[model samples]
Target: MIAIGFEGSANKIGVGIIKHTPDGKVEVLANVRHTYITPPGQGFLPRDTAVHHRAHVIPLTKQALEKASLKPSDVDCICFTKGPGMGAPLVSVAIAARTLSLLWGKPLVAVNHCIGHIEMGRMITGAKNPVVLYVSGGNTQVIAYAEHRYRIFGETIDIAVGNCLDRFARILNLPNDPSPGYNIEQGAKRGKKFFELPYAVKGMDVSFSGILSYIETLSTTHLKTGKCTAEDLCFSLQETVFAMLVEITERAMAHIGSSEVLIVGGVGCNERLQDMMGKMVAQRGGYLFATDERFCIDNGLMIAQAGILMFKTGHVTPLEDTWCTQRYRTDEVLVTWR
Candidate 1:
C-alpha cells in the first residue's frame, strides 16, 4: 500500500510518499519540503503561513509523486496532520488533503502531529518502546508507551523550548533563513562565556517563559552596555534549557525503567540537545536514538507513516470529521496498531 502525506502544521510545507510492502517493509519513496521563512526579527503569522501552504501544496504533491515515479492511482490513502499546530496552516493542508481524497477516491486519515513525530522516530531509529523526548517550537513532552497509549510523563507548563530560543533569536535579530533555532545553535558555537539564566523545572513539567523573560532582560542589558555578546546569550540559553530538558528526561527514564531514549520533533535536530541527551542516556547504561533533518523536523513522511498505520487498522476520517485543531493532545488517540 502507498500513502501520500501532507504536513503544513507550521512554516514548513512538506509532501511525502511511502510504500508498505506485503512483508511489512516500509520505503520512503519521496519526501519534499519547503519552508516559509520570515525576515530577521519577524515571526511568521498564521495567515501568511496558511497562504504559503495553500500555494505550494499542489506543486509539492506533484513533485513528490514525480520523485517517487508513481501516479496518483498508485496511492491507497491520503494522510495529513490534523492538529496541535497553527490552526490556519493545519486547515490549509487538511483542505488540500480532503480535495485529493475526493478526487482520487482514497481514504483520508487524520493524524495527530505529536504522534506523527513519535512514530516517525521509531520507524527511522527502530527504537521499540523507548522514552520519547518530543520538543518543538510549539510543544515539549516526555512520553512513554503504556497501556496501549503514548502517555505523557512531562511537558512544558509555559512556552516551549524552541519558542524561547526563537524569541531570543529575535532579540538578537538573527537571520531566519533556515530557522531561528538553527541560527542560535550556530551562534552558540562561537560563544566563549556562559551567563546565568533561570532554570525552572517543577516535578515532571518544565517552564521556559521565565527563562525567556530573564534572557530578554539580559539582552536588554547587553544592548545598553555591551557587557555580553549575542553568542554568549545563545550559548547560555541553550545550556540552561537543554539541562532542564535532560533533567526531566532522565527523571522520566528512571521512573519508567526504560534506558533507551528517543528524541523527536524539530528541536530534536539540534546537535547540542542531542549531545546532552546522549550523555544522560549513557549514564543510565542505554543509548539515545535520533533521526536526521529529514525525519527530525516537521515533514510529511512522519504523517504518512503514522497515518498508514491507522489506515491499516480500519481508521478513516469522514469529511465532516476532517476539521483541523490547534490543541490535539498526543494521548488522545488510541494506538490500535500497536
Candidate 2:
C-alpha cells in the first residue's frame, strides 16, 4: 500500500509519502518539512499560523507528491491529523486532505495527533505491548496497551511537558524560534553543575507549573541582584524536569509490570530526557526506545504508516467522518486496524 500524509498540528508543516511492501516493511519515499516561527513560548497563533499554512500547505503537498514521483491516483489513501490540534490549523490540513481524497477517489484516515507519537515509536522499534510515554507540546502521558488499544495510565494534571520547557526557554531569554525542547537542550549543554531549582514529583503524576514559576522567580531575582549564572539555571531546570519524568515513568513501569518502555512525542527528542529514561529503564532491566525528529515531532510518515495499517484493516473514515475537533481522547479509540 502506498499513501500520502499531511501534518499541520503545530508550527512545522509536514507532508510525506510512504510505501508499504508485500513483506510488511515500510519505506518513506518523500518527507518534507516547512516551519513557521511564533512569538516566544508560543508554537502558534490561530490567526497567523492558519494564514501561514494556507499559503504553503497546497504547494508542500504537491512537492511531496512530486518528490515521491507519485500522483494522487497512485496513492492508495490520504491520511491526516484530524483532531487534538489548533482548530484553525486542523481545519486547514483537514480541508486539504479531504479535497485530495475526494478528487483522487482514495480512502481517508483521520488520526489523533498524540497517538501518532506512540504509533511512531511502535513502528520504529517494532515493539508491541510496550509501555508508552508520550511527551510533547500539548501532552505528557504514561500509556499502556490493552485489548488492541493503547490507553493513558497517567498524564499531566496541568500544563504539558513541552509547554513547560518552552515557557522556561522564554523566561531564560533563549531562542524559541526552533523547537522549545531543542533550545532548552542547547542551553543545558553549555552548563556545568546543576542549579538548585524546585523539583516536584507527586506519586504517578508530576507538576512543572510550580517549577516553571520558581524558575521565573529566580530569573527575576538574579537579574536584580546579579548573583546567579544562566548556564547553571538551565542545567538545574532540565535536571529537575527530566528527573520528575524519569521517576514517574519508572514507577509506572513497575505498577503496570511492563519491562519495555518507549518514549514518544516531540519532547522525547531531548538528549537529557533520553539519557535519563535510558538509564532508568536499563537499570530495571527494561528497554527504552525513542524516535528521531523524523517521527518524533509531528510529521506525515507516522500518519501514512498508521493509515496504511488501519485502512488495510477496514478502519477507514467515510466522507461523513470528516469533521474536526479540539479534543480527542486516546483511550476511547479502539484500534480497528490490526
TM-score of every candidate: 0.99, 0.95
lDDT of 2 at 108: 92
Pairs that collide in candidate 1 are none
lDDT of 2: 0.82
For model 1, the stretches where C-alpha displacement exceeds 4 angstroms are: none
Q: Give the root-mean-square deviation of each candidate in angstroms.
A: 0.7, 1.6
lDDT of 2 by residue, 1-338 (tens): 89788888777778888898999888879888787876674546877777877788889888988898887778998989887878898888888889888888988999887777777679888886778888988888888887877777788888888888888777766766666679778878887766677767777787888888988888788757867677767888888888888888888789879898888888988878999999998999988888788778888877777777777888789989888888887886777764
Worst 10 residues of 2 by lDDT: 38-47
lDDT of 1 by residue, 89-120 (tens): 99999999999999999989999999999999
